[model samples]
Target chain A: MNLFKIVTKNMRQRALATTLTGISVALAVALTVAIVHIKRGMQQRFEQSTLGYEMVIGAKGSPLQLVLNTVFNLDISPGNIPWTLVEKLQADRRVKAAVPFSVGDNYRGFRIIGTTGAFGETFGYKLAEGRWFTCSIEALRDAFKEALEHSQERIAKEKGDAPAKPAAHHHNAAEAVIGATVAQETGLRVGQKFIAAHGVEVSPNAEEHTDNPWTITGILAPTGTAVDRGLYINLDSFYHIEGHEVRDAPKDNDPDPGQVSAIALKLRSPIHAFPIYREINDGEEAMAAFPAVEVRKLFAIVGNIDRILLAQAILIGLVAGVAIAVSIYNSMSERRREIAILRALGARRGTIFAIVVLEAVAICAAGAVAGVAGGHLIVMVANAALRHVSGFTVAPLTMEVAELWVVAGSVALGALAGIGPAWRAYRTEVAENLAPTS
Target chain B: MNDAVLSLREVRKSYREADGNRLDVIQVGQFELAAGDQIALVGSSGSGKSTLLNLIAGILLPDAGVVCVNGTDITQLPEAKRDRFRAGNIGYVFQSFNLLQGFTALENVRLGQMFGNGTGDAVELLKKVDLAHRLHHKPRALSVGEQQRVAIARALVNAPALVLADEPTGSLDAANGTAVLELLRQVCTEGRHTLLMVTHDPAVMRHFERVVRLEELR
Candidate 1:
């Protein structure tokens, strides 16, 4: 009896067109929602991971690579910088903490990073269970000396020279602290032992270090960041692995047989950052990069792709609007008699026009509401793939204010699309159309 | 005349032929229908009997003249006001029973009541037409007799002062047509509403006490 009822009747009368157009709107909205959600989530996770890591110093190469490698446990490390650079940054007055990391191993595809006990304390990371792995400056220095001797003996044997008899070495039990996700995935408890794969990612032919198995001494609490996906081992134990021998040339008297993949720096004050960055970049030893700035730059590049995706979504929406317009306009031919009947029954031309317009609006409004729900469902399903690619998943159920605007925009689009058809209905000749056809 | 429920003065209607000549459809000097009058205006095919009914219902505006219904000149009213006036004062029934196919019988009658702002019970009106059990049936599902009865219920739902029936029984078989015509006339007589029915059927014309030819009105 109401205009709304009339519109529902009209829409029900054209259910196929209604459903098809509605699905098109839902498709556009779903894609847009997924894009916006994943973008926001990745940006937030990247920013959060960079919180304690004000600066990352690595081998002279892409700064984004260094941040991704050091802070996010993503992309492979560019190369190693000499350990003397870590010592220098640690001793600097402007540096509050400088934690070195070495990577070249994985346990079932989760990266195994060798770092000091200071990593957890410096970054405010907490142990969920058990204890930190045994790691100290003295142990690191002694391990470096042993690695230098091992390399020297290899060089002598390769050169067909008489190799000196190696001194007796004390075997230290290698220990590791697993990340939350690492523990959950590998089912590694405090007392469990795990051997490392020789590469960052799992490969069928990847070599496993069965000889250098590490005991899990601790598990980290979930920080909702890249830390959850990393396995931390003692830096001293890292040098004891055969392939991880020091690459520096031995000086014999003061053999600098130590190198690290990356060093994360926490500045005493942000004002001292640029000077320290310049100091590191100026030296041939390493390059210094701000993690936050690098993250922003990375997303800035990604934003263009997001914009293109958003443009496609908008284009779909516009096409849907036009389809609605064309569809309702086409239906006006069949509706002339109905319109004439309504007019003959004392309904005004304006009332007939409103009925046509309201029908379109109702269709879009229904589609938009269904689209929002379908969008959230897309987000939920996409989160698994997102976690695989980025170690982060956007919260699917969280609503954005922009979604309200999306619904409103679709309703407005419906109204605009209805204008031509409504005008056609308004201008229909009542008396002529009402005449019975054979 | 003072108590007339329907009045027409100097009413003229015309259409331009496809070949550019003007064709006059209706030219009536003056006509009046008193309250409760059941008059049949008979005309042959294409004689503009339907056109005259449309003019009275305010569905088609006269090219020249005044159309007064219930003492108010509907021709002088704006299109919107005239529509509202038509809804309140005039009821129209077409030969084909133009009920919206999407709606049930009850909803179709309520649709008329909605535009007229009438508070009459639509169920009561359908019950009067002996369609109480068929209130939920769509036009296509109903027999021709039931469809015309639904149309009659819709026309009188607002209890308007004048009812216009253009070949109201034209599309039905004789048996159903006679039954629908009697039901329509009974309802109109009971409500004391003035009825102006257009028909070419002699059987239908005999049912009316007063039959006016379209030419005689001109």
Candidate 2:
């Protein structure tokens, strides 16, 4: 019989120990593999969500909060910056494109953002159906002019210095473009209309823009970003809403209409990013945040969590290796006579050593295979759940180079663990063990 | 002397006792066995019969002298070379029939030829031992006599010049012992292989063509 057959037969002789040891190794590997997959998925999602935007300019606050609010739509914005600042940034030669976003409203749980057509173009969003809102400068100017004329006519008719009623004016219908996830969750098709709430929370007493209902002009395709969970409306319509109008006296640098939550800036050249960031942050009106920098800080915190989990996985693998060593060492005592018999039958010390080592390697190899498969299965299930809940999808079963290294390292650990027992088998004296009593 | 298939000269072996004292196990000045000769070595319980068998099989290196098998001194070779030389030239049958437990009778016989210079059919060897019917049976499934028969088949499968049998019938009953001894003699004579066996029973020693007492050899 071949050495492999003999080794396998010996392992089969102690089936319970072999299987238990393999299971320990498998559990360790599965945990490590799953953790790595999740870490990689999160990193990729963070990177993709902030693609193209170099900096976010918003009211002076936490840069990370500004990024979270504007880029990921994860937190409440720290109030708003003047729209005049956005106009000034748009006029700058260093700024390639300055897309303004007006936030602080929601439809269901999804954020409703007021932006121009340039926002969609700048973010590389494609429409699944219908068309983008007709948000040109001409449209905004004409709508503003019509509102001003109606306000004047109302003031003249009421002679007693009363507040101009916006309800009396017949303005153009405000248009809205919905994201793939927003459309799916709300079941709002093109040509349907929905009113916006004043804030993100769903409450019975929350104020709604009942008179300024918006028509769904388009639905964006899935982009696997925060944009996929937002509702987009024209900036002009956003300011015209009842509660959104600027009531305080306008500052010298503030726009006459109102404020925008944040301005997403694309640089003319990547080299100008730092310079422009410094210039914007140095200004009193706004704070500038590099999305990549803020995201890196965020991931550093996440990376610590990953490190702790990775350490636990490594500890588990080491314990599994020890388990294999202990189990094999325990069996060595019982197999002393068998090893002596092999030595008596012309088998060398090296042969016996190789057989024992091969047994350990086989167990680890089998365990690693099962673990990788089990890990991917977990990722697949988690991906489905995450997609359903948050509209964020991570591709499952992606085998990274680090995982391959882990597999190789696990096999090496198995071999190393077997060395002690193999040495014991190698040092077995044939004459002593072959005694009749033994 | 020229035709001697197995020979030993000034071979001595010792072990350290638990009390830090040296104990001489075996010390033989001279020994020789001619090709195809069948002999029994009679010894007491502590006479180091097993140690002598190990020396002849090159399983243990002598503390001081040469163990020559088929004209080559095995003591001069390295441990690895000695193992290879022993596998090719010498065969051994243990007192308790040291057959591998998990392997079938046929496979056990084949295992003997694994490191040998030439391969032989294990089934044919089993047939030579009259164990053809039990070729697929493991050692646990065989009777003492039947297991000994399989061990004898394994020893002869490599076509060695000399076979060492250490208390070959020590565990068998008288009837089974006589049958197994006769089978070993008949096969060795037919195959022209020399047999050196260790035993304490006079009745079993009578089956050999010649006998040597361990006290005299020492």
Candidate 3:
């Protein structure tokens, strides 16, 4: 009896067209929503992961690759820096804390990072199960001296000379702390022991360091960052593994020849960051980069692809709008009799016009609601691939204010698309159209 | 004529042919029907019988005259006002029934009532037309006679001062047509509403006490 009832009846009469057109709108909206949502989610996650890391020092290479390797645990390290530089940074008055990490192995696809006992405390990572593993500067220096002796023996043996017996390095127990996801996926508990496999990624042909097994000492709480996906082990225990000797042996009475993949620095003051970054990058041994700036540059390059995808989604939305207009416009001819009948029942022309427009709006409004839900589902499914690629997954359930604008834009699109057909219904001649057609 | 429920004077309507010739359809100088009167208006096909009815309902405007339902000159009102005026003051029944196919019988009647601000009970009116059992049936599901009966109930829903029916039973069989005609005349008499029905069939004219030819009105 009401105008809404009339519009509903009209939509029901043409249910197939209504449904097909509605799904098209939903498809466009879902794509647009997923793109906007994932882009923002991933950017937030990437940026949030860099919060405490003021600067990262690595081998001279792409600053982006260094950040990706150090901050996110994705991509291979550019190269290595000497452990003396780590000791130097640690001794600096301007440097607050310098946590060095050496990466060259994995256990069941999860990377095993060799770091000091200060790592968890420096990064504010909380333990969920056991205490942190024991490591000290003295144990690390002994491991380095022992590695140097081994390198010398290998060199003497290669030259057909009887090699000197290398001094055995005295180090702490080979203990490890596991990230939340690593422990869950590997089922490695606090007392469990696991062997390291050569290389940072999983491979069947990769050699396993079976002779040097590290016992798990702790499991970290879920941080919703790359920290949740790693297996950290004592750096001194890492040096005891075979084939880990420093390749570039230092001369007698030289500084420690030990090498590490990278060092993450926390500044003593905000003002000290620029001077220290310039000082490190100016040197020939290593390069320093701000993790935050490198991430911005990376996404700036990646933002182009995001823009292109968003444009395609918008184009699809425009096509859907046109399809709605054409579908309803074509229906006006068949509905002239119905419109005339309503007129004969004394419905105003404006009322008839509103009915047609409302029908279009109803179709789109329904599609938009369904599209928002579908968009969230797309994010939930995409989180797996995102995790595998970046070692970080965006939070899937959080809603953005832009989603409200998307729904509103869709409703406005429906209104624009309905105008042409509504005008046709308004102009129908009551007397000429009242008669029945064959 | 002051008590006349329907009146038309010096009314003229014409259409322009594809060749640009003006073809006159209605040229009635005077016509008046009092309240409670039941009159059958007869004309040959294409002789403007429905045209005059449309003019009276304000569904079509005459080229040059006034159509008064009660005392208001509908031709003087703007198109929107005329539309509102028609909703409350007039009722129309078409030959083809003109029922929306998607709506049930009761819904169709309710649609009519919605526009005219009617207060009558649609179910009771359908029951009066012997369609209480078929109230929920859509037009496609109803027999032709039942559809015409629903149309009749819709026309009287607003209790208009003037009711115009153009071939109300033209699509029905002889027996159903007679029953529909009896129901229409009985309802008009009971409600004290004036009825003007247009049809070429003499069988339909026989039911009315006063029959007017289109030529005589002109």
> What is the C-alpha local distance difference test score of candidate 1?
0.90
Q: Model 1, range A1-438, lDDT digits (tens) per residue?
A: 899999999999999998998888777777777777778878988899999998999999999999999999888999998898888889999999999999999998899999998899999999999999989888898888788878888888888998888666665669998889888877899999999999888898999999999999999999989999999999999988887876635677754778899999988999999999998898887999999999999999999999999999989988988899999999999999999888877899999999988988887788888888888898889888987887777889988877888889889988998999999999999989996566
Off by over 4 Å in 3: B1-3
What docking grade applies to model 3? high
Instruction: State candidate 3's DockQ.
Output: 0.81
Local accuracy by lDDT, each model: 0.90, 0.84, 0.90
Report chain B TM per candidate: 0.98, 0.97, 0.97
* Per-residue accuracy of model 2 over B105-135 as CA lDDT, tens digit each: 9888888888675487889889988898999
Q: Score the docking of each candidate (DockQ).
A: 0.77, 0.58, 0.81
Query: Which is the winner by DockQ between candidate 1 and candidate 3?
Result: 3
What is candidate 3's TM-score for chain B alone?
Answer: 0.97
- Candidate 2 local lDDT, A1-438, one digit each (tens): 788888888888889999999898888888888889878886788789899878999999899989988988777898888767888889999888999998878888788898898998887899999999877665555544444444454555667665555444444569999999899888999999999888965567789889889999999998878788899999778766655644343333422444689999988899988888888889898999989899899999989999999999889989999999899988988889989888877788999999999888878877888888877887887886765444466777668888897788789988988899999999988888886452
TM-scores for all predictions: 0.96, 0.86, 0.96
Which sections of candidate 2 miss by over 4 Å? A105-110, A128-130, A138-163, A167-222, A231-233, A236-255, A381-391, A436-438, B1-3, B18-22, B104-107, B123-138, B186-190, B216-218
Question: Least lDDT summed over 10 consecutive residues: which range in candidate 2 chain B?
Answer: B113-122
lDDT of 1 by residue, B1-218 (tens): 37788889999999999999999999999899999999999889999998898888888899999888999988888999988888888989889999999999999999998899988889999999999999999999999889999989989988999999989899999999999999999999999989999999999999989999999977
Reported per model, the fraction of native interface contacts reproduced equals 0.73, 0.55, 0.78
Top candidate on lDDT is 3
